[model samples]
Target: MQKNGFPLDELDFAILSCLQKDGRMSFTVIAEKLNVSIGTIRTRVNKLIEEGTINIIGRVNPAKVGFGAYAQIAIYVRPATLKDKVAQKIARLPEVSFLAMTSGDYDLEVDVMCRDNDHLVQFINEISKIEGVYQTKTTLYFKVYKYAQPDLNLLK
Candidate 1:
């Protein structure tokens, strides 16, 4: 399927690679790195925002955010209404951070951060009500060893 929102180009990808590493980096700094004018950097950043391809926000580490638990839930859906209404509801829930619909043993995978066991239980109970959802298997993450954005170096 053709995805909507910003159609990324090489320069846009370069800008994103830089900003993803440090969201607070200024336009002047990015312009220097990308060998583009400061004006160009500003335009690209604004376009990214307008197209909904980027949101410059402080992405809190779960530990710092007081999320005592992080879990992944795999959900199986009925054949009738796969990702339509069900995924929409999951996306709106406060605890849900990352959601992806996939073709495999599970129809969807949802990542959630919770304050505690009670919070996790509550989220699980509430999210099950999403239409067309049939079953779910959840796995808690104990130690987050590594999480990194792809380095642009390898793409060279």
Candidate 2:
């Protein structure tokens, strides 16, 4: 498979599959499972990291961690030119979990997590204060049924 012009083989996919299951999975374990040498697994993982193909990070469930309010906010930025600048400002917010510029009625979309309803209200007030923000529509997620990474096996 080609990723950002870098060629990746079956071994690479296998290694990624193992890592997806458990980010902290050891090179020794992956090597044994894939029937390859430990050095090979280590080298491949390093290469993947350097190429910006993947990052192993601890995933957290917001609800379990006391973040009870989850929301998606659609922002309308006037003059359009300030969209990038506005996005940069929003991205710095710790409560913001995801932010993207899209083509539609709104210029930007943001997903945020907060401790509760009051915290969410405060967050909205904070974002609304940003310069160039004309308006915003916030949608609260009552429940998230599924949240997961893409299945690497599909690449096969």
Candidate 3:
């Protein structure tokens, strides 16, 4: 089935669903479970990766890694034309994990991770000094619950 200009067959969707459940699952195991040849599974998996349809990676807990402070910041750029440029510069900051150019009161939204409240303050100060940055509003995240992958069944 092709969705959003991506050509993905049933087998491709199955392979992706399986990997989403357990990214570490071996090709042999997946093949056995799916009742297909191991080589076929391997080829499909590689094709999926090459096509940028899926990515298998390990994710870490930010708090466990000493980044206890988390916040989302909304930035208003001085000129609308500078939004992308400013967002690109902010994306390069080490403290910024996620950045998006938005259309609303704020020109951009950023997710930042820091060691503590002091670190967050320092990071905010650094952002304030960037050119084209007009104003910013930040909301601290006390707890985060993330779902790595949503249920594939919903795609149906």
Candidate 4:
């Protein structure tokens, strides 16, 4: 593990890879595959979670769940100082599934999920009412080929 990078060893990478493939896989199964004890696997997984190295989560397909409107919105904030505040406000919105402070033409970007076109329009209208938000450009997703976290191979 490098000092400035994520503090993960080979075992940690292997554990993450296994979890990515099957988040519900038993620790015993992983241990058996890695030739480690169950207790060791448990301890290591706990440590990884404690250090914020990995998050075990159940993901759902938004489209299958009736959220058909998926859009990426770029928001331009009036004053640079208000960027964080606007992002926080946007992040609190239920429609916003993902939010990030960005360095580009836009100050912030958000991924929004809505039931349909009407819901999406309403959401965008609501966002336009935010005080510091000067402008917003929305790009609707026609299809999502992939939606998952970064591959564990990058850890190598």
Top model number, lDDT: 2
lDDT for position 18 in model 4? 94
Off by over 4 Å in 2: none
**Which model, 1 or 3, shows the larger TM-score?**
3
Tens-place lDDT per residue, model 1, 1-156, is 122644677888889888998999999999999999999999999988888877889777888769998999999989746677798889999999889998889989999999988999899988777668889999999978876666756655
Clash count of each predicted structure: 0, 0, 0, 0
TM-score of 3: 0.90
Clashing pairs in 1: none
List model 3 lDDT by residue over 23-124, tens digit each. Answer: 999999999999999999999999888878888888778988899899999999997888878888898999988899888899999999999999999999
Any idea what lDDT model 3 has?
0.89
| lDDT (C-alpha) at residue 132 in model 3 | 90
How do the candidates rank by lDDT, highest first?
2, 4, 3, 1
| Runs with alpha carbons beyond 4 Å of true place in candidate 1 | 1-9, 152-156
In order of appearance, the predictions have TM-scores of 0.83, 0.94, 0.90, 0.94
Clashing pairs in 2: none
Candidate 2, RMSD to the unseen true structure: 1.2
* Candidate 1 TM-score versus the reference: 0.83
